[model samples]
Target: MSDEQGFSPRERRASFTLAGIFGMRMLGLFMIMPVFALYGQDLIGFSPLWVGIVIGVYGLTQAILQIPVGWLSDRIGRKPVIYAGLALFALGSVVAALSDSVYGVAIGRVLQGSGAIAGAILALAADITREENRTKAMAIIGVCIGISFAIAMVLGPVLAAFIGLSGVFWTTALLALVGILMVRFMLPEQAHRGQIRDVTAAPELFGRLLKDRQLLRLDFGIMLLHLTLTAVFVAFPLTLLDAGLVAEHHWWLYLPTLLLSFVLIVPFLILGARRNMNKQLFQASILVMMAALLLMAAGQGQLWLLALAMMLYFTAFNFMEASLPAFLSMLAPAGAKGTAMGIYSTSQFFGAFLGGVLGGLLYQQLGGGGVFVLVAVCMAFWFWLATGMTNVSKVRSHILSIGVNIENKDQREQLLQRLMALPGVHEALIIPEEGAAYLKVDGNIFELDQARRLINL
Candidate 1:
């Protein structure tokens, strides 16, 4: 059953199982987003501000714990950390389901965020997949997450109408439990442990990564993007209600917009990747998002206008979400990709949290228009920063195994010098400790067979 590309049964099993589990966990987190602003009114002590807190508190906790949890996985084994995190998530879900007060729900959300297992899951994906195929494996997980978010948006209101908010929380708890079981029985066990260069974060490299300007710009961009997203969701449900679309029928709008956005984003993604037009496309997407925010601000409760804005918003959102990570992968230092990603992810979650709090305050003080204006202003700043970003070359990351016995410094330096001389190798780093040589290479010019023989020798 192996594919022509040579993915073995174990790798495929690990990829699919981990992707499914990640998708399920994300579905639970997102299902409440579309309905929360409106339905939160039913809880005692509910206010726009507290509701925003309940909706966003998870991000704050996730921001606080994501790196530490990933670091924990490195020490305790991937499966063990995953199990514990999922268990915490399930417990939080139950707590949320039983809550009748906004404060209680917010507490549950904090606990849910505390479970943060994204780093651990990614580390495991890297562990099971070979370096050449790692990107594809990661892409599989990314696709699963995007699809889950779309489905969750469509299903959130429908589920809320049928079973109430509590029901949704209970369902999320069940999903987490299912994820726990998947981890235990379905995911392939790894025979090796410790940080994988492309996956787990390195504490020692944090200082260097923090000082990297290009990486910082990308990090800032993600922070603003998620900030805009969380802020919009803080007020968007009310916008729908104001436009006469009842809660139950909201999915009708979400489904069509999501589908259309997916269709629209594909072309841009292709053009960006194939043409090395990511910098241009990335800035363009930000501009499009700003335009969408402006439209929402001016839509005046018209359903048609709001729908159009949503479509535009999702199109830009999907594009940026896909492109940013690609850019990060390309720009990160060879051995510190994991640390770079960890910092990037933390900025993203913190942005979500800040957006929730600030978006809520803005909505409370100045209404929906205020929220849109805030997002638009932030996006405008992002657009300015994005214009200065260095264009990433169209290249792929490849890793070559250095036999464990080749530990001599002189040998490694000699090997690195030889690798650098190879045609199409943009950058090469030989890590003696990891026993691997990481390279950035142009596929069109790189001689894979030649490189393979040299490494094998």
Candidate 2:
């Protein structure tokens, strides 16, 4: 049960568990994208604006609670929080399925967003897998998303055509329930790291994250990326339908386009990782995405042109999706991986919310071209911010959470200073209240035994 990258038995199993959970969750989302807007208009009191807001409401809820949920998972353990989120999401899906009005659907979507367990899921995966193997876990999740998006695009319109929007929501609810079952049966029960339990306040959790410029840039990039994605989907289907492509045949466009993008993305990611070309790949992908958006805006009323633009856009989109997390891993401070990811995930959801709300408004007024133009502008801003980031190699880092028993403030300070001075220690935070210190160190340069010897734990 080892991976190609040489994961141990536990790591391999955990990666598979994460892949399943992420895939199921994304399927619930992707199921809505292709037809939600058009079919949703038939729901009572459905305005174009309300439809867009409903589309994005989940992201808003997810954005607001992602950090808090991750923090809670750190304190209370991952599985319980995850189960709560899943139950909430399932409730939301059922509610949306039965709702007859846009407002009701909106409420359900927000609840669905509440079930977004990204932070908890990632932290749990991090707890189980070693740093060297973390990327593989992330990669498996990434592949699941890619697959889910492709399948969803293919299924969404057909399902909507046959059974309507309510059926889609019902199916989504079923998939979410299946995810809960998988978690119960497949995932291992692991203990939370007892260290770092004292720094539980929200302000303190996010305070350290606010200081890093590079991480902030990545956070901004994720927000804009999702925002652009949501915005484009808002208009793409209608535009295609206007160009004479039926909703049922939409998969004809998505399937090939997604496959092509995947082919392009994998090579680019390998090149970026091996050659340390992440910055270059990131910059180029953003530019490509911008061009694609502008092209879509200008190519309105022409189906072939729109398809070409979509091909270009998704190629860049897939590449960036795979690359950004890798970049975040490189730039984030060593000991606060969960904290750093919390902020990143929160921003992403916020961006998704904004994109849906704003895209819907723009479409109702200025139409498809306007939506594309707005997305392009967002990408331009992200590009400017990312260009200034320092180039970071794909070196692996570790967070060592060790228990401590210091009797006095002076003793704690002395221990903190000594740990910080260690040759490969990049950063260390000692919390006397928690009786533990979080250390970030280069795995290649530091020995785990050295810390054990220092603490004699």
Candidate 3:
């Protein structure tokens, strides 16, 4: 049943099913982005600030609970936590669907975020896939997320026009229910849990990762990226409206811009990955975003200009979204990747919340121009911080099992030194508690069979 890539049928099923479930959940979350500002204004107590709150409150809840929820999954079980999270999401969607006031909708958004199942779902995915195939499984999930975002952007306005905002909430609720059912029936139950050191966050490593300036900078970068993204959406729809684009026709702008931006980002991605220009490409992408924000602030009431700005913004956004994680993976300490990523994810959600609140406050006090200016300022700061980031080496992470009998500290250190002496090995750590050796290696020169034989000894 094994494929050429060594993935068994069950692993393949888990990967695709889990990816679909993640996609469905994200689709529900993103479907509200395009039309929330326009439609939210109709609710009671609908200030610009509340509109931003309603749009972003979910992130606040998500930020607070994602890590704890993952911890809970480890203690009880993955499926149970996933079920509870999805149920919470569905309940929140129903609440939003029934709300007549902005505050009510904000409450629902908070509940929606309380689901916070991302970590748990990823843990479950790790539990099921082989270590070597884990990256491929995660890539499948990543692709699903990208596709869901693209589809949601195009579909949000169209769905809003057809069914109204409440109906969109209802649809989201239904999607969450579907996700719950999939978890119940479709995913294979994990038998024995492996030490997924790379993917599952370890709480003990938080302080170390937080203090590492390199990882902290990357964390801040993700935060600022999502913050700017949310803040822009808070104002962008209104900008389109002022330029005479109707709510129903908004997709006309998003569809073409998104398509063109995807096309435009390919060259940068290629150069960054193929030519080892990631650092240069990363900095340039941020600069592009800053320029786009500046254009947005200055080009009020100009439809064509706004569209061009959006194209620039999305091109950079897409590139950064893809690149940041790769950078994080490369920069994370050998045993602390999960904790580093967990913090990064938390920062991202917090940024979304801050962006919503800041965007709303600025729009209310200083108008849409203020929102753009604020985002531009944040982007500039991000650019400054990014300049100090070191380029990570092109090393890949690998994990090998060590027998539990090798418990002595001297023996462990001796094994670690031997592993590090391998041709392609850059770093190796043998954790006696986990009975595994985590490695960073240049794959081109790393002799896998030789490493395996050494570990078995």
Which candidate comes out best when scored by TM-score? 1
Question: TM-score per candidate, in order?
Answer: 0.97, 0.87, 0.96
Residue 124 displacement (Å), model 1:
0.9
Q: Which of the two, 1 or 3, has more TM-score?
A: 1
The parts of candidate 1 lying over 4 Å away from their true place are: 1-4
Count of residue pairs whose backbone atoms collide, per candidate = 0, 0, 0
Model 3 over residues 212-273: C-alpha lDDT tens digits?
A: 99999999999999999888988999999998999999999999999999999989888887
Global CA lDDT computed for model 1: 0.87
Candidate 2, 88-171: lDDT as tens digits = 888998999999999888898888889868767776776677645765776787778778877888788888889889999888
The pairs that clash in candidate 3 are none
lDDT of 2: 0.79
Model 3 Cα shift for residue 17 (angstroms): 1.0
lDDT of 1 by residue, 1-457 (tens): 6664667888888998999999998898888889888887889998778857777779998999999999888888889888988899899999999999988888888888888999999989988887667888899999999999999998889899999999999999999999999988998778555767677788898999999999999999999998888889889999889989998899999999999999999899888778888899999999999999999999958999999999999999999998889899888876678888999999998998988898888989989988998789999999999988988886667777788536688888888888888999888887677777878787779887788777777
